[model samples]
Target: MSALETVRIREAGATLAAEAARFSGYGWMRGTSGNLSLVLDRDPLVLAVTASGLDKSELTDTDIVLIDGDGVSIDGDDPRPPSAEAGLHAHIAARTGAGAVFHVHAFDAVIAGHRWPGGIELRDMEMLKGIGHSAHDETVWIPVIENDQDMTVEADHFDRVYVPATAEVPEVPVLIVANHGMYAWGADAAEARRHLEIAEWLVRFTVATR
Candidate 1:
């Protein structure tokens, strides 16, 4: 299913929350350091996203909130809000039809971004094909954007810059947030989780074998 594949806000919200909750166990997104999202519908425009600053490890269904493309909360009576990077997830879903976007601050991904500061180049890895790339020779250019406090500005810049830069390579589903985390997207929440694992593996391998 594509990101545009619509579903009820409740279903979408629950799935995103569960995925975020599970990712916490990997010890990468430990202590609420990541966010998750899935597009709910396209007509009225909505997304189910993880609430901001919540501990992912012990998340509940209440932690999810439906938001518009601009990150406006639409559903859930909860007073808390979605993740700050929620806008970036919406921007990606709008552009890529990615059913889910999972982001986490894995040590290797973050360290690689800081060491490279521009991007991380992955090559000659057989698992590269898992993301649909045809050859190990294919280099995935993970955009490394400088982390910002203003999620709005960062989201705008992501669309204006990162999207355009990687438009020619849609198969690459992961992008690095400098000194922050890796943003991984896929056709659904399960796919997103798998890609996040693969992305983390790729970066970890790159760092280890360097």
Candidate 2:
């Protein structure tokens, strides 16, 4: 990698680290459970993913590892391992053209997923507009898939449920892994964070009022 490219990635890592830390402060990513990733370059498919088992509350640029499209760590001499969900991130990016992806282990997400294993359908909520629906009558469905210990198995399940954004899918930015957590993505880091924040909040509100 060129020196300039390395600098750019480090900068992006610093910014993403801060975002992850803020989510951790919100009790969403307590400990080292959740993972965050940003696509650094598309042609070469370089991504900066959170290092495995690193406390999100204390995330730093160095806690990010550079990986290739295949989710293999390509960061030279960086002993840190990429997040176990790295492959999942790659799949989302490839399928959705997302520049960033976030996975969070939040209480509301787990609760909602269990309560609505078929899927969580939010309707008549003002926040529905924030998720891209044009009107109040529209319903937003967040699919809940069963979680698996094997990342490959989880990815396969996600592929089955995840339909690429078409008229039917309506650009749904988040999904839940039953009793596990939520996955959100967007065109970039900020958008991904916004989607995640909005999705999680919507679930919390739904669960509280029920």
TM-score for each model = 0.87, 0.94
Give the per-residue lDDT digits (tens) of candidate 1, residues 1-210. Answer: 344432365566667667766777777779878888877677766778888887888776657777888777875566787788887888788777888888888899999988887778877788777666645556676667888878777776566445432545655788888888899888888888888888888889888988
lDDT of 2 by residue, 1-210 (tens): 789987888887898799898999999999988999999888878788999988899987767988888788986788888998898888788778899999999899999999999998888877766667644767778889998877778878888888666775477889899988999999988888888988888999989998
> Which stretches of model 2 miss by more than 4 angstroms?
167-169
lDDT of 2 at 60: 79
Best model per TM-score: 2
Residue 146 error for model 1, in Å? 1.0
lDDT (Cα) of model 1: 0.77
